[model samples]
Target: MVVATRELPASGYALEVDGRFKAEFATRDGARAGAEELKKRFPMLQVRIYDALTRAREDVQLPRA
Candidate 1:
């Protein structure tokens, strides 16, 4: 399933899969790091980051394209 993350101070990263919450983190950067790993494990899944406070979403860019 595709995974997404919402970074927030309280939840850190409200991780989701298939538009449903799956996990949580402690920091945005940490969540970004987690998303990196998620991309590696789920190569076909498109992972992204979202701002929980402002409701902003950001796509996760992999290294070396």
Candidate 2:
């Protein structure tokens, strides 16, 4: 099976993975709060909150063979 992924924009506040919106906060502190909110809304898939401002930027793509 091939899974598709997307590289979210720098200013993107949320991500839609497989039709589901993965909420991402603007700051780490905010992300922490968003994490809790996301968990309450969606109890599936692991929610990862990142520091969009300080964290190193990287291109995210689907796994390739």
Candidate 3:
């Protein structure tokens, strides 16, 4: 599983996982908050964050449960 954020000019950011839209955030902080939520929801999977603007992708580091 992977989570990503796409920037929206008017709305802020859009969160997605596996090519599906999961949520919309009003700011970068909100998107990061969404990422944390995703980590909590899927601890066993390899979650990641991708920045559409930078074209960079990295795996999400989940805290030990």
Candidate 4:
């Protein structure tokens, strides 16, 4: 039996909700915008942006009104 393997893009941004990957974007700004929108809609849920290349995660926090 033969199996095929899939590889992730070398550089891209991903949005994670509650420690699970929700979506991926081509640009960092896009990912940030998505995270912000999700955070606004669900204030109790944890949102973060992950960098595929750097393997880094940044937490998203809402601004105080």
Which candidate wins on lDDT?
Answer: 4
- Candidate 2: worst-modelled 10 consecutive residues by lDDT: 55-64
lDDT of 3 by residue, 1-65 (tens): 13333443234455556555455555566667777787788766554444555644455576665
Q: Give the clash count for model 1.
A: 0
lDDT of each: 0.61, 0.45, 0.55, 0.77
Considering TM-score, which of the candidate structures 1 and 4 is the better prediction for this target?
A: 4
Q: Give each model a TM-score.
A: 0.64, 0.40, 0.51, 0.82
Candidate 1, residue 60: the lDDT equals 68
- Distance (Å) between predicted and true CA of 40, model 2? 1.9
Model 3 steric clash total: 0
Q: After superposition, how far is residue 30 of candidate 2 from its true place, in Å?
A: 1.3
Residues 1-65 of candidate 1: C-alpha lDDT, one tens digit per residue: 22333434343455554454555666787778877888788867666665566666566657765
15 Cα displacement, candidate 2 (Å): 6.7
Top candidate when judged by TM-score against the true structure: 4
Of the pair 1 and 2, which is ahead by TM-score? 1
Name the better of 2 and 3 by lDDT. 3
